[model samples]
Target: MAERIRTLTGHLVRHTGKKSPDVQNVSGNLSPAVQSSFRYTLENPLKTLTKNQRNFYEENGYLVIKYLVPVSALQSYRKRFAEICNGECTVPGLTVMKDVALAKSSPIQGEKAVVKIQDFQYDDALFQYCCLPQIIRYVENFTGPNIMAMHTMLINKPPDLGKKTSRHPVHQDLHYFPFRPADRIVCSWTAMEKVHRQNGCLVVVPGSHQGDLKPHSYPKWEGGVNKMYHGITNFDPTLPMVHLEMDPGDTVFFHPLLIHGSGTNRTDSFRKAISCHYASTDCHFIDIAGTSQENLAEEVIDLAVKRTGLPREDIQFKDIWTLKSRCVKGEQNHLQGY
Candidate 1:
């Protein structure tokens, strides 16, 4: 118990986030049953999920579909990533390493300074992977037949001596989204290579999505990225979390509301993963004002105001969602807005 407390405290200090005292208690000493219940897994063939697979996802908020992507597909992804790293790709969405001198001057240094290619779907290879037949079939289990690829990211975690930016603070995916019917929203996170505890693999709390969205805020880490997104500010310490260790082609389909994050890549090599957030066209955009969604919206809008020099009042939830969204599958329903 003391060791766990120390672990949590260390994570809190290093991550630049705050957790309420009550939330911390959840992680305190407890029996094995409590911890075991928090870790779960359901596996099925790559083509689609079985009946039990859907049940496990409903009960636990996540499903791990092994070998969903063939090795050849992963090889293609690797080639694309290599091209971006080697400066061979001039694609607009590829996030390139910035000038070393300028990057080093920032408060966050070393591996914590990893770059992410946002909306990499703009690239041909990634776009195909986003709509891969196997992936789409798995997503249909949650979103029915109508699915839209709402977000995509290729996160490159640089090796870190201190495991700093290599890890993300625990948070819910829906917090960053303005859409509703969260139950219909899912994420397919595919491991591009071997991912394990030492390489900062994802960690998630089972059944965390069964409740409403929780509060989130930026961690107070000094010298951190200025525009970083908010994360769960408080959580029950007792909630069991599993460190997702996967090999290439193993993908996890998860609920948007699940409390999840990753550790730092302690190894010498960089860890890469490609993920897409999918939502049903049946979902609708909701007004964030005067709602639980207000906090995150305010943070996002504030950044926009600073970046574009626009007034906060002029910004609407719909505007933000539209700017960040791209329809990859079915048509987007415009009428489902506040």
Candidate 2:
């Protein structure tokens, strides 16, 4: 029945020998409510969502909701997605640009994607599904109220020829967005494809989120800020590395700085996912690298101009935005495209 359910749990072949490492002094402890939620992990294997299973999301930055969007919702989104996707006709963001010259120039596997919707700056589904009630309540269960929408994105990795697998490297996401200590920023990835070990799904190092988020070279995702990979690594021989085994409509939520990456898609099908990052309104974007908080926000404006939409209010960064340069020249994006 587990096999029939198709949610296979396995460790990474490369890291198969690696065990979960233990810490002498855990950097942080899980809240009681968060710890208790793990008890309700999905038992049916094919179930949509389980209350107890939500604990992982609280303790860790992410959780996997089996069958998150029903097949009907998924199909409906797909149809609308297709229409929006068609509009791009091979612009920078849309993968379906395959039918166009630039997209045709680069093939995931000789097949070009006709990206209808290009990047999150334009994609709408992210707001519709990424901030789902179930997802919001999941976070509210821990962080309480005053949650605010941070940023949203839709990745149209076209079938056969996509970036997620081959070109995609490992990295921590939160490092891209600076947040205060008390306020946490969370991200959720919803699979529009049958994400499995065979087709290059998300792989994460459990408990790794609690450690130093290693510095990495900025990755060149089609629509996202160039991101870097891990902060540190010390293999333990007990706990196992796991792939975010997921299916269309299944959603996985993780922390801002979780060390994670995916393998290349050597398969024939398309792998589509929607990622949304949320931060509590109470969570302030701070920069602590300065000697004092004085003029810190102003000093970083040139640096953070890339991260527009950030409120003009003063902030004290808790993480180093300079860990990796926000040198992204995302200037030519379709901002005012009609």
Candidate 3:
């Protein structure tokens, strides 16, 4: 059954090996809840964000920071990603190419035709962009001076043809994360090409991050695996959804709890974007039991079992999270680090 599932899904279950070189000592004696309250001092003033930008993000839960990357630099990244996808790059990373069988389903089912290249920052060219000093300062404005890039991805959203993958359901980023202090986590999404409603720009519900963590579930689809992504259950349509239409080099830093998702690409071209989740190393991962987090964790564990051909009972939630979590900057001082 596992072999058949692998044949059907063509999933790439690879692990990341990158670690933050500058190891720093952090207090490990504190409890998870107490550790979340810890804050780091910023090296500079609030120069990264103007008074108005600060007000907007505090009130709306997101900010669209324009010209974070130059178009020339983004174009180089675009070329590099394309080359990696074409097997021109020899560096090892998890690359999920477009699945033809899933794309040809009658009703257009399973995951979308989008290709997701995870942990591409291993490449020096891509690493430079992820650690751009100016951008890191902007991230420091929100997450403090001591920050770590927990997750990064190069997503190529293909055009829509009844493809469910092209259109992501409105969901909270916290659903996939096991860490605490949701306020300290931020995701920077940069457009590699001009993006608008036609090309599936991100749509986020303002002020959604201020609320509590909500339950999440997979949207009903034919032959779909949870895929470690869980969306908010029964998201209210009455809430306003803002379309984040942006040009190449434009980036948006959003809170983890913000309810956001992208629409299907109605145009013919692929919508490319590079994103990374920056988190405070001071925060710890609390044990989530009997909560929506545990529920989603189980969903992810099932997927991992199928992909690794491991028994469900043999896998623990912590093991799965430890595999996914990495420290991109500073040191990993959280529970997983020890």
Ordered by TM-score, highest first, the candidates read 3, 1, 2
Better of 1 and 3 by lDDT: 3
Using TM-score, give the best candidate's number. 3
lDDT of 2 by residue, 66-123 (tens): 7766676566566656655545222212222232223435543222354223233223
Predicted structure with the largest lDDT when compared to the true one: 3
- Which wins on lDDT, candidate 1 or candidate 2? 1
lDDT of 1 by residue, 1-338 (tens): 23432332232122213211111111122122222232222222332566667668878899998989988988887778767656675553233443232366656643335456655544666656777877876776666555577777777777664527556778899888888788778999999899999998999998888978887778765535324546677656678899889999999999988999888667988788888898877788777778767876777667556555555566565564544444555446752211
Global CA lDDT computed for model 2: 0.46
Ten-residue stretch with the least lDDT total in model 3: 24-33
Residue-pair clashes per prediction, in order, are 6, 37, 1
Q: What's the candidate order when arranged by decreasing lDDT?
A: 3, 1, 2
C-alpha lDDT values of all predictions: 0.66, 0.46, 0.68
Decoy 3 TM-score against native: 0.79
At residue 310, what lDDT does model 1 achieve? 54
C-alpha displacement of 68 in model 3, angstroms? 0.9
In model 1, state the lDDT of residue 100. 31
Model 3 misplaced regions, further than 4 Å? 1-46, 90-114, 121-123, 163-165, 221-229, 309-315, 335-338
